[model samples]
Target chain A: MRRDRSIIKNEKSLRTYITPPADLYETPDAYILYIDLPGVTKENLNIKVVDNSLIVQGKFELSLPKDSDTMFSELAKGEYRREFVLAGDVDRNKIDAKLVNGVLILTLGKKEESKEIEIKIE
Target chain B: MTLVRWSPLRDLATEIFDLQREINKMFDRFFRGFEEEEEVRISTWSPRVDISETDDEYIVRAEIPGVSKDDVKVTIRDNVLTISGEKKQEKETKNENFHRIERVYGSFTRSFTLPGAVKVDKVEAKFKDGVLTIKLPKVEEAKTKEIEVKVG
Candidate 1:
């Protein structure tokens, strides 16, 4: 029966989607993002890149028994949506998305010209 | 003003209380700036859970993303249901440069006292997509019953 302030705040926004927590990492050639979306499956997940922004949306429904009453609740139900602004050097066409263990992994590859290359002197 | 006698014991108690308050304030100030970093180092986070009940059974669901099924454990004792698990971070990211990190990783435990007796042997649990669902069937005596009456 532990009550967290963030859970109570999320309950107030039940009608809207929750902003899932995320992590961002930068490698030599790509930027990777991981978003936690528990209970979301591949079928209900949507990812798209529009302009320079990457939008991610996922919906999950918990099916309960008929005529059931919720005794205690802290888990957020409904949709999850998050958007990130892509950098200018990111190659939109090379972006990849994967859903693994309820986490959405997005890899935004850098453009060919943006990647660092060793210069040779004669 | 009436003259009051000063007791050494009371004076010592007051001094100790003042010292305790000052120490607490100092610790608060010291930890306030590094709360996030401290959380990352400790890595203990509780997963959100939902519990529901119907006429015959109770259902519990917990959101534990990035945790493997083998890492989770469920148990019931003394009418208390407990779910515990550890969420491991990806190994490859250990040395990577992280631009931002908001997701939590570590062990967590949550327990709830059951409202009614349940058939402990009939409990079923399933894990999928990082959500753990538990179904606990209530005992025969604990099931709710509805009655209908005829109108005259």
Candidate 2:
């Protein structure tokens, strides 16, 4: 019986959450961050940047009608909250956020003073 | 969909996937409202709410599905209103293939700090259609009243 219980415990721990993949890339003008968040909606998401910290939050709603019963449940439902410390080069004022499909795209441009500019002489 | 040995459409598929993810995030944020990290939990989606004033009392509504009245716990502490509850999972399934499972379970705790004094003893909560509604009637002194205006 003890051996059987151990196997059940192992199986429960083996069931893990699939971490969504994200990518952060830099361009000449901006740093772009792409996050993959499947089975999510625009109505339950939030993004905020305070000083050097960037916080992203999202909730997945899973309510069914009154006479509904579940045959199976695989998708996990809860709030998604993640935070990141911003690099000094990121321009807090010029950051842009856009959501399409189930992914979140954030573009943080360089500070205004750091942009490359060419001098013109008449 | 057939895959060709050399197809530029592969890149198009990746772009479409990216766009879908972005749109999903936008919609999620619009409905979540403001939340603090302390509200974290394994499951249970608690929505942010705005409480309004009325002539008699204040109205508060919370979205808590799959939870019965007996599973919920309401308490008032230090002028903060707290609601905590659990939604137990249904009976186990023996054999079934699920394409999608999206309902949230487990427990959740949500608190709101009142701006004015509340008659805690008189507070009431009602659950209907997966929504939890609370009424916090104000005390006699806490009630808002219009005063006569005098020219300065």
Task: Give per-residue lDDT, candidate 1, residue A60.
Answer: 86
Once superposed on the true structure, which residue ranges of model 1 sit more than 4 Å away at CA?
A1-15, A118-122, B1-43, B91-96, B146-152
Q: Give the alpha carbon lDDT tens digit for every residue of A1-122 in model 2.
A: 98997798589556444444455666657777655554356666788986578877776665443443232233445666656688788889888887654556788899878776778998
lDDT per residue, candidate 2, B10-126, as tens digits?
A: 879989989987976775464343222343334455543445456566666555544667887878787777778886544233333222234455788776566568898899987
Worst 10 residues of 2 chain B by lDDT: B91-100
Candidate 2: what lDDT? 0.63
Model 2 residue A34 lDDT score: 59
Q: Share of real contacts kept by model 2?
A: 0.00
Please give each candidate's TM-score: 0.75, 0.40
Compared with the true structure, the alpha-carbon lDDT of candidate 1 equals 0.83
